[model samples]
Target: MTLRLSSMRKGIRRLAAVDVGTNTVRMLVVSETEEGFRPVIRMRRITGMGKALRETGAIGAPEFAASLDALRDFRKELDRLGVVEYRACGTAALRESSNREEFLAEAARAGIPVGIITAREESRLTWEGISGGGGTGDGTLLMDIGGGSTELIAGPGKRDFVSLPIGVVLLSASFPLSEPPRSWELSNLGHFLAERIEAGTDLWKRRRFRRMVGTAGTFTTLAALERRMRIYRPERIDGVRMTLAKVRRWEKRLAGMTEAARLALPGMEKGRERYIVFGVCQAVAAMERFRIEDLTISDAGLLEGILRGLCGRKGRG
Candidate 1:
């Protein structure tokens, strides 16, 4: 075998990963280094694909166009950056759509290949991503709270993971709330999620985790909003410990506010405000159901996992 100069200078290579999740589509580009992988470009947009799916069995006309357009733009940016390899996949929204083929066709038209991943795959990749943040063992579960679904995975090596239809969007759809949800409305939402969180409930009953590492939007936003950090600082939020008490605190505070007020609050994103109360509820439910004393938040998720896989493959070959 001939030795290549590029092999010794592999740290200069870059790769990309894209996650077409229910509520948001995100992409990340990173470069490999002796120190580890470092990020080059990151983009995320909430196109409300899942919200559209809930209202209709498919991505609505406008939603469809917007999502594909965003993707095409990302592809151009990735190309501009000279990313050597990229992987892209879609989760719950694409999985549940009755007209998923339409979305797939659009992606193909845009020259972007988007794979529809199963619930199990979503959980596993989420686990893979968070685990890369370190601390896999010693009774820690990786939890991903999405707009369309929630995943709970315990024991990374054993792969004890399940993706439930329980999500902020799902819960919001199931239990419509008034601005400042009526006590009864909140009760119904609690009861609705209580039944579906059985996977976590069962796990925590038998085993108590020392801590949990949470990924995806809900955890990240909650952590930032709690501290009133208008500017996102991934370094400060990542691996930071959040107590159950804080979860409940935010839950109660948000429940008392109207959608407009919630949106006006610091760290609250415009489109995400209304559904976030439910997100907080799910977080509280998870802490209680999983018997977790605290949570460590990780911003890395499906996109990061795919980037690692693609980058690692290139480095090896």
Candidate 2:
């Protein structure tokens, strides 16, 4: 049975989930009840895990160190919070890492066994995360713009899904544009992004999606920055609506600023400055390609999906 938004409150109690990605590691603790799952705690650390991924094809010392520290902290929290039900999953960065096993072993030592999810699994999780949240109405397309890859899943039924390798961190390394990225550079970047998305599926053209829901860091951060938030407030970002015009406006505005200027902007994270340009452009490209006029930004994603999975798959080794 599909877990509808209203039904998410049933089954299980306290659940914890961790999502390790190319640029960030995040943990969430929630309690499922009659109303819905209310967040007990949320923690995120920008580890820059994929900064050198494409160039090296392995986890480097700096990023790996960050991961170890983050995972260790996450484990401590799970213990302290008395979270018996939990799941930790890794995405694109770990999927591409030659030394991912080493990282996984280290994570296990911290009391959290990390599983690298397949792109298909990632897409399904993302879709579940969105659908379970209840904002999609009849049906909506969910897009998760990650550092190492972009996952798009069309839903209500999740009729189609695809995970593209063109992520913000990877694009940043591939296209080293000058500070205040030039028009030609942004154009080229947009084209490259659109080509991949276009080639990803014909579903967008054939099926009429009612709405678009964007998940992951890129979308949420953009929403935060638009509001000029000094600190990220998930409540303020969740279910917030953004139009394609706003996406383009931010794209142009950010492209005219230097790296330092981008960092100085409210809601901009220091480690992500290098990739935000391309990341924002990719979001813009997606909205245009899908012919979506507006989108709802979602702060919930893989971690939430993992938690829901744990609640559903109660008995497992």
In candidate 1, what are the lDDT values of residues 202-301, reduced to their tens digit? 6556777878788888888887787687766667678767898877888999899999998888877667887888888887877777778888888887
Q: Write the per-residue lDDT of candidate 2 for residues 17-135, one digit (tens) a residue.
A: 88899989988877766655678778788888888888999888999999889889888877766676788899999999999999999899988899999988888888777677344
Structure candidate 2, residue pairs in collision: none
Residue runs of model 2 more than 4 Å from their true location after superposition: 1-13, 133-135, 156-159, 315-317
Error of 1 at 147 (Å): 1.8
How close is every model to the real structure, measured as TM-score?
Answer: 0.91, 0.91
Once fitted onto the true fold, the runs of candidate 1 whose alpha carbons sit more than 4 angstroms away are 1-11, 133-135, 157-159, 199-204, 315-317
Cα error, residue 215 of model 2, in Å, equals: 0.7
lDDT of 1 at 222: 84
Local distance difference test values of all predictions, in order:
0.76, 0.81
How well does model 2 score by local distance difference test? 0.81
